[model samples]
Target: MSHGVKKRKLDKNAQESLYFDSYSDVTIHEEMIADRVRTSTYRAAILRNAEAIRGRVVLDVGAGTGVLSVFCAQAGAGRVYAVEACSIAEQAVKIVKQNQMEDRIEVIRGTVETIDLPESVDVIVSEWMGYALLHESMLGSVLFARDKWLKPGGLILPCRAELYVAPVSDPVVEERLNFWCTVRDQYGVDMSCMSDFAKRCILSGDIAVTPVTVEDVLSHPARIAELDLRSVTAEQLRSVRGEFACECFGSSAVNALCVWFTVTFPCEDNKTLVLSTSPFKPETHWKQAVLYLDEPTDVMQDTKVAGEIHMYPSEDSARHICIHVDYTIGEHKKHSKTFSIPDGYSEAQQ
Candidate 1:
């Protein structure tokens, strides 16, 4: 089961920092639960699969407030282990008791990777997705849990996930970028030169979590990558690589590339439930990730924007991410750029 990729280990101080950054407050959990798209999807997925959950042992990774664990218990799970690594686990214990499922649900306050479970479980459930699907680094813990405690044929709540990208026209970003030039004209000063610096500051090589409308999408989205939770390893998540090709709908200025993800829950009778954070779909708390180019590129109908994307954890901080994109538009020369999610913006903003 070795993925053959060396996993980066975080030192004790870095681990503590990450833990505090992620779970220092209740606001983060509130935002997640308030996201109807995310919370409802898991609720429906679990309720729809009641047959699979009934009398089966289940594990909820990073079980914030034990919501998913409670859902499993309501679905008739024989026993539910809610594993949380932060102080929030203590709150989850109270929530489980308040719901009167104390006997069926046990809140374990520890990281799933190192936590001890009495026995293997029949299902693993987790709401571990971050902005752009990989920012928080929680999926790695879920994978570690799967390898250690999942039964041979146990189910994962979100069995499959897909990452997508497309060319987009972001007017807000365009206006912001244009503000630098406008300052020179409005104030009659030679401040236009700062436009380059402004672009750098705005496009700071990080994934911009912003709302993108369907009209903003200038091209058809291309599937950049996918992961099957049932078998994917933590090491395999260290780097994800894929090729994408998107065709412009018509002549338009492509200022940024938009990225989003869709996760699917398997159900009986060959059915599957999908939760999409696509711009065309209802918005989630995740919104969509926008990677701005240094400048806008013009494209005509049928213009092909093709590229390869490589996403991995940043070396300096495992919770942060580094993205390398190499792309070509129509007859244009290939361009490559590297983007990083800075340490401070890693989890706090998400």
Candidate 2:
């Protein structure tokens, strides 16, 4: 139930540098590589599509540690251009050599948009998904590589993606909101007055990234947006807007909207491989994005919450994501709110 707010806006260059610098830390990469659901799904997708990769030149965009590039090489890719803009590329260079894949892999330490390859690639692979599918804005780089280097009819490792949303009853929010009352009883200090201030601080800005369980969900999930990586354009990604209407399973108070995503890989024999970050499925590094409501709304069985959700890059930092939600619960008046996914940079001085 913790939240963060950006105290000051950063210039584009500073923001870009901060984003890459964070990736240089080994901890972040360790989390990603250790996410079994995330790593194994990608491995299955690459191996399942081995025929498409064999004898083909491939490009791995934002290739942190070059794991995916190695997978492609093992799948018999003729050559792999592993493009990484962060210092992690140095580790990727060592990893490729240690795997005895130096001949098939070329680690390029530059942004995909600025890097030049000797020839077009028959396949483009990348694990560019961020929280809730678009938070980090890495899809833009993948699209750039796709347009600049992918051969005609070339395949995207995860060819399609979908974002989903549903109303949820989060007991943790209520517990946090009520903690101030406990302080008064414990220490004879009337800190209960801070409840309003605490709520204000939480709902003020920044979306919470937490693990949501199926029991917490109050309604069936609805698909809000689907992106076909092969054809979706950068302009289209600038703002992804979709409308959703979900019915509550029973009586409960809705505290927030739970969001997650899934990506698919098209394989041979008409089979499709899916990697989901849904709470109903095994958890991944991307647990879920929860947008807390200013006030909880109680609903009865079959109550409907209808709304439109809009996701876009923050104007201050293109790498950050902003979400706008306009929704009406049952027959109540419409409620509108916007939340931002924090850039995770250092807090600005007060």
lDDT tens readout by residue for model 1, 1-350: 13496656688577666765577577888888999999999999999999999999999998988999999999999999998878888899899989999999999988886779989999999988887899765888888888889999989999999999999998888788788788767888777788787787887677788899999899878999999998888888988999999989998888788889999999975799999999999999889988888768899999999999999987766766778899888888888878765545645554
- What lDDT would each prediction earn against the true structure? 0.86, 0.90
Tell me how far the alpha carbon of residue 212 in candidate 1 is from the true structure, in angstroms, after superposition.
0.9
Mark the regions of model 2 whose C-alpha exceeds 4 Å error after superposition: 1-8, 343-350
lDDT of 2 at 24: 89
Steric clash pairs (candidate 2): none
lDDT of candidate model 2 versus the reference: 0.90
Positional deviation of residue 211's Cα in model 2 after best superposition, in angstroms: 0.6
lDDT of 2 by residue, 230-332 (tens): 9999999999999999999999999899989999999986989999999999989889999998889999999999899999988888878899999999999
Clashing pairs in 1: none
Residue 314 CA displacement from its true place in model 2, Å: 0.5
